[model samples]
Structures are given as structure tokens and as C-alpha cells.
Target: MVPFSLTAAHGSIHASTKQVGCQPLASKGLNHTEQQAGEFRSSRRLVLLLGIASASSLQRPASATPYKEAENIQYGLSNGNIRPCPGGYNPNCVSTASLNDLYSPVWRSSLTSIATSAQVLDSAVMQSSDKAQIVIKRSMPNAEYLEYEVPGLFGRDFMEFLIKADKGAGGAGEENSEGAIVLYRSIAGNVKYLYPFQTAISDFGAQRKRLEAIRQTLGWRKLGCDLKECFE
Candidate 1:
């Protein structure tokens, strides 16, 4: 039962502490065209980094035993029924089951169906996990659940989603017009942000906050846009 930690792309998995950092490219002597090219390259590199964000941080022997489903943190399952963090658990996890304002509301997808929702979730999954570490634990026509080791304090999390055939917000199957209602949730194994004290930096309600970011990111992708353009 060894704990895992992500140290950005620098340290190994299960490192003492996990982290992620960004290093901006030096732009001192570049002319306008070169600087713009550099910025585009940076954005593309960031997209790749995010797709396999946890891979570079893992360090394990070839002989290490494989992880079993029984060892998974059962925050319910990856299906539509995932519940809130366990009683007395740390503040690191969030879910749609939570009525608390700290949790992000479920996301509505631009398209819905076994095919389309799967397309988006599939892309999200690759963006979130290392190929070697992710495991598809459950699957159904309208639902999917996966578990993987991330570079972090606990190094494991579950991502689940269910696609409703109905158009979003009580509308039916407007998968093209309004899309379907998609329920998505992710929960981490780090319940104790701090050993015994919950402070402002403990990442409390973080999962709650990422929803908007995810929405914005998806919008950008659909429009074939990148973050640099927004900033400029």
C-alpha cells in the first residue's frame, strides 16, 4: 500500500510530494514573427503535456505488481452513481452528488449519445491520464468509468460520465442543436489536504471550480482556438 505523489514532470510517481509547474519560453531576442511562432509552439506543447500530464512523473520497477480493481478507491463507481466523498474524508474530492456549493455542477455536453459523448470523454480521458496507468474499469451504453494514477499526493482518481439521450435541460435528443445532458465527475484519493487542519490552500472545493475551466477549454477547442489568442 505505497502512496503515490506527482512532482510535475520532474520527479517520479509516488514521490514525496506531487506538483505541476509551467516554464515560459525565453522571448528576449526574438523578432515579431519568431515570437508568434514560439507562442504557437508553446500552446501546442502544453496541449500534449496536458494529454499525458501524469506519465512523466511515474517511476516504478518492471516487477511491480499490477493494480487490481479491489485496490481501487471505490467512490462508488465510474458510472452515473458516484457519490460524494466519504464521511469525515478530507476536502480534496468533489462530486455531483454533493449538494454543497463547493462542488462543480454537472457539465452539459455539446453532443450526446454513445458515439458523440464517448468522443468527448475519450479525448478528455487521454488528456487526463497516462496511457500506461489508466484502466477502464466499467462501461455501458450511457456510462463509462476509468481509474488511473496521477502525479499527486495520492496519485489516483476516478473519472466517470453518463450521457442522457435527452437534449440538455429537459429537452430531448437535440444532440446537434442543443446536445444532450452529460453527467461527469472526478474524485481524488487525497482526502486530507492537510493532516489535521483544513486551510485556505488545502485545495478545498477545487474540483468544484474546474467545471467552468473545462467548459471554456472545450469551447476553445471547438472553435479551433488557443489560450494565447485570448491573452493577446
Candidate 2:
């Protein structure tokens, strides 16, 4: 028979092995809890930060409202748009029918449709083969001009942004501000111009000066007419 002391020692060794195994399992459980807590705290902090950011944004001041464009005239070509008349007209009513009819050829050649409210005129026929300079004069007094060209965008219409500024001499004094409008045009076969809503002659003059400054800074050739009469 085995000695009594030897049996007791064997039991002790078995108990010690079991204790060692259980100690690691308990330590693993503790580590898992700590990891989960850290993740939960991080998520909570993220949610709190997002909520604070949203609240701050809501407290900011609102932007100024934009100016509204004029309504379309009742009579003209294809949708009551102002086109060059068959014959020129009296200087008093330069925007009227007779004057538009006179410039019909130019209007017919370049303009496809004119959006009065948007202050944009789209070129109907694509004149890609020949390089041509397009000129547009509208009856709308406050109508301004911007030109851009893009292919297959805006339903294949040449992109044009209508911009306006005061045509008065006062615009010459202050040319840098948010009130200044910008027009963009691409070199593709698209031809478009932007006209801002009812602006004074002074505003257009100031906008023109700012554009000239940008052109000078970028080393680009000056484009388009800066006639005070046009802006007025």
C-alpha cells in the first residue's frame, strides 16, 4: 500500500494545479469587463460631442435672403422669351419686339431657350465646327451676364449662371464683398452667361472691377465688354 504521507502529497499537487487554472480564467473575465467599459465610455463621449456640435450649429445666425429674378414676358419666340426683333426699335423701348426681330439672325443662331427668371439663355444649335464670338443683348434692364460651356450637363444645355450688380457709378467705389456676383464658363462648345437679379449700375461696375482683379491675378486675358451703358 502507498504511504499515507505520499497520498496526501499527491492530493495537494492536484489542488494546486486546479487553483492555477482557475486564477487565469478569473483574470480573463476581469480584463474583458474593463475592455467593454472602455468601449462604452468612448461611444458615449462620441455621442455627446455630436449632440453638442449640432446644438452649436443650430444657434448660428441665418444667411441673407437672395434677390428674386423678374417674371417672363407674355410674347416672344418659342416660350415668350425676348429674342432680337425683326427690325430695331426706339431707344426708349429697346427691349421691345421690333428691336428683337431685327437681331433675329443672331438670336436664332445662338439662343435655344431663354429662362427669364434664371437670367440664362441656352444655345440651341451646336456650332462646334466654326469658332464664333457670340453676343447677347436682352431687354431686361437688370439682367447681367456670365458665360460657361459644358458637354452633356444640365440636359446638354450650356451651363450659364446669371449674375447682376448695380450699374451705377457707385459700384466703382466698393468692388469687394459678398454682394459681388461671379460667372463661370467652360471652353467646351457650350456658351452661357449668368445674369444676377435686378442690380443697380453701380453694383455691376464694382463686380466688373473685382473680375478684372481676379483676371490680373491669374494672368488670364481680359474677356468681354465693360460698357457702363450695358450695366446701366
Candidate 3:
């Protein structure tokens, strides 16, 4: 039996690697006619070359680096449980098909921890409102993004309230004086920063430490912390 590599699309049956990269060929060989025989062989060679190229492209490189968030990666099924990445105050939590829950209760808890930690760190070092902005990014099969623009967005303000209401502590500090309006606003705009922003968030040393600890506890592949504080 051939091992099947599956790739999925929106609400569609998983496509096998063959279907993605190979074409079916007639079993019959070149016929009796000499003139037709040459043409048949040429056609077969062309088809074979195309198929090879396609297959090569589809093959996952053995040396390819692993996706950083494989543990947090959620598989979306057309008919399976989906606890989607929750949004702010009005979270749209659903366990229906066409969705897969990426953010779980535990994941939300982690977000809360990071948020509190972020706020604490900010208080210690923050000197400008510009450095206080909190950014959030969500990834899925397609590009579906939701962002919240809050003033004086320090710490985990974006993740905590969105995932677990008011679990994150916040102070008006200097942001409140400038605004008479409720600071939170669902900025209805295209999410262009999903990938890079996620990278930025992941680069934070504290997050990397938490991820390393979680991975180690799970007995998955472990990572080393170069920073003295993180290792301790």
C-alpha cells in the first residue's frame, strides 16, 4: 500500500499527493503502426516529465524546517469540533463544521499569563505610548483576521480580554486622558500582518521560554534557552 499524503482545502475532501501532482496514464503501450508509435512514445515522455516535475514540487522536503506552532496547529474538518480563536468582548465560539478550534481553554490561559507578564514588563520599561501597543494575529485556512485597536495597549490587553474576559489587568495610565470614548474598537480592515506579527510575538523571550517549557513537559522536541534568565 502506498502512503498517502493529504492536503485539505475549505470544506473539500482531502486531496492526495497523487491527485495534486500526478496525471493518469493509459495502461496500453504504443500501437502497431510505426508512425503512430513514435508519436505515442513522445507523448508518453512529455506526460512523464510533467508528472515528475509536479510530484517533485509537491513532495515535502525532508530537510524543511518544522513549522514553529505545530503543537498549537489545529486541523480544520468539515464535520468536526471547532473551537475557533475567540475574538474580543463578543467572542464567536462555535463547535460546528467548516471550523476547527485552534485556541483552546488552556491556550487562552497561556494568553492570560503572557498578557499579565507583558503588562508587568511594560510597567518596568515602558517610556512611551508608542511602545505600549499590543498586536494580535489569527491564522486559518484562508486569510480571516480580526484585530482590536485599544489605547495604551500594554501587556496582553489584546489576547486576554479577547480570549478570557478582563482576566488581564490594565490601567488608563496616560491613555485615558486623551480619549473620552471607550478605547476598544474592532478595526474592520484586512489583516496584512498575520505572519510577520506572529513572528514578532513569538520572538519575545518570555513566550519562547513558555513554549519551550510546554514542549519539554509534553516530551516533544526540546529547545534550549540562551538567555540566562529564561533558562533559570
Model 1 C-alpha RMSD to native? 27.8
In order, the Cα lDDT scores of the candidates are 0.48, 0.31, 0.29
- State the TM-score for model 1: 0.47
Superposing every Cα of model 3 onto the true structure, what RMSD results? 19.6
In model 1, the runs with Cα more than 4 Å from the true position are 1-73, 78-80, 128-133, 146-149, 167-177, 193-201, 204-206, 209-212, 220-232
Query: Candidate order by TM-score, highest to lowest?
Result: 1, 3, 2
For candidate 2, lDDT tens digit of each residue in 132-194?
233433433344443332232212222223333323314444322323232322211211223
For each of the candidates, the C-alpha root-mean-square deviation to the true structure, in angstroms, is 27.8, 22.1, 19.6
Please, what are the lDDT tens digits per residue for candidate 1 over residues 115-204?
Answer: 666567566656643542555545654454544444443554455455455433343323444454545566555443333443312454
Task: Rate residue 191 of model 1 by lDDT.
Answer: 42
TM-score of each: 0.47, 0.17, 0.18
Off by over 4 Å in 3: 1-32, 59-232
- For model 1 the local lDDT of residue 168 reads 32
**Winner by lDDT between candidate 3 and candidate 2:** 2
| lDDT for position 229 in model 3 | 39
